[model samples]
Target: DKNEKIYVSYDSTNKNCKAGDIEMAEYGHPKNDVGAPIINYSIAYDMTNEKPLLYESYPGSIVDVSQLKYMLEKIRGYGYKKIGFILDRGYFSKANIQFMDSCDYDFVMMVKGRASFVHGLIMEHMGEFESKRACSIKAYRTYGMTVKAKLYADDETDRYFHIYYKAKKQASERARLEADLDRMEAEMDKIKG
Candidate 1:
């Protein structure tokens, strides 16, 4: 929980991990997507109130949550207790949710519209987003730190999106204007005039 004052961090990658040594005969053969080579990385943080700790590294997908569960369980063996797994949208999945629930752990994760339908439901309530000064307490109670943030709605989809925005902070306003100018120039270039 943000109110709990805990540690936070992230994991990412710039290159793909080698799937495996290719067989001499399989050099150009069709390959499994997992065997097609995807980037692999992970992040771990110590979410013990006030103090922050973060660690990240490349650990092939095979050692992912399986290793994570092993490590967390071992930590419990050494006597550590915790709550909620916070993760990026890539790590969100029905299986992950079920695993966490079964293990008595709560979590916070961003949902990607490409991966799940939950994002659509969230979009439905975006117009009623709570302001920075105003929050829907009852919604929080029901959704567990989840709230529909008021963001731009898509005209075709009518989907609401929550986004972080500076309230007219000058630096950001200048940046937005610069981006707009760039966009206009690009549009002008595309025209047949």
Candidate 2:
């Protein structure tokens, strides 16, 4: 009913609960990074007003990805005529994307660097990218971090992928990958010893 642009962010928070005190509380990876009997409460917020739209609690063991279906349905029930969703990387998946597309919802989610298909696409188009500031927002960020974006239509899935590149992020990702490999090798040696 409102004319203002609608945006929502999906996220979760985990909290420790006492035994028999909170229903659906069980062991899962704690967002606090502490091993405890915690329950995760997944919440969606209307970004414009920052109001809570819907929330669902799951066992501590349930991963965030598995809860997207439940949360998506809750948002759809809100009956928003025109709205766009902004979700974090953890919520990105082919199945989730397909589901959202099937429901005819507009969403923006970042595909992870580890996704092989996205990686291949990036490699295929990396050379075609030329440095440019398309608009004011891009111009402002260009001094520190330059961005290049391209839109590609996927005929197989009937989906379109808008891939963005940041020079800083690309360099950092390479360094991070090398560090991870070194750390893994060290851990493996310790395990063998």
Point to the candidate with the largest TM-score. 2
Cα lDDT over the full model 1 = 0.46
1-193, model 2: which lDDT tens digit per residue? Answer: 5445678888887898766767677888776756568988877888888788777888888888788987877666766656678888878766777777777678877767557767776676665443544422364343222233332355244445655656776679899999999999999999994
Q: After superposition, how far is residue 176 of candidate 2 from its true place, in Å?
A: 6.7
Q: Give the Cα error of residue 20 in candidate 2, in Å.
A: 6.4
RMSD of 1: 10.4
The lDDT values for all models are 0.46, 0.70
Off by over 4 Å in 2: 2-5, 16-20, 130-157, 170-193
Number of clashing pairs per prediction, in order: 0, 2
Q: State in Å the error of residue 3, model 2.
A: 9.6
Task: Compare the candidates by lDDT and give the number of the best one.
Answer: 2
In model 2, the Cα lDDT at residue 15 comes to 90
Worst 10 residues of 2 by lDDT: 142-151
**Model 1 regions more than 4 Å off:** 1-39, 49-79, 113-116, 130-193
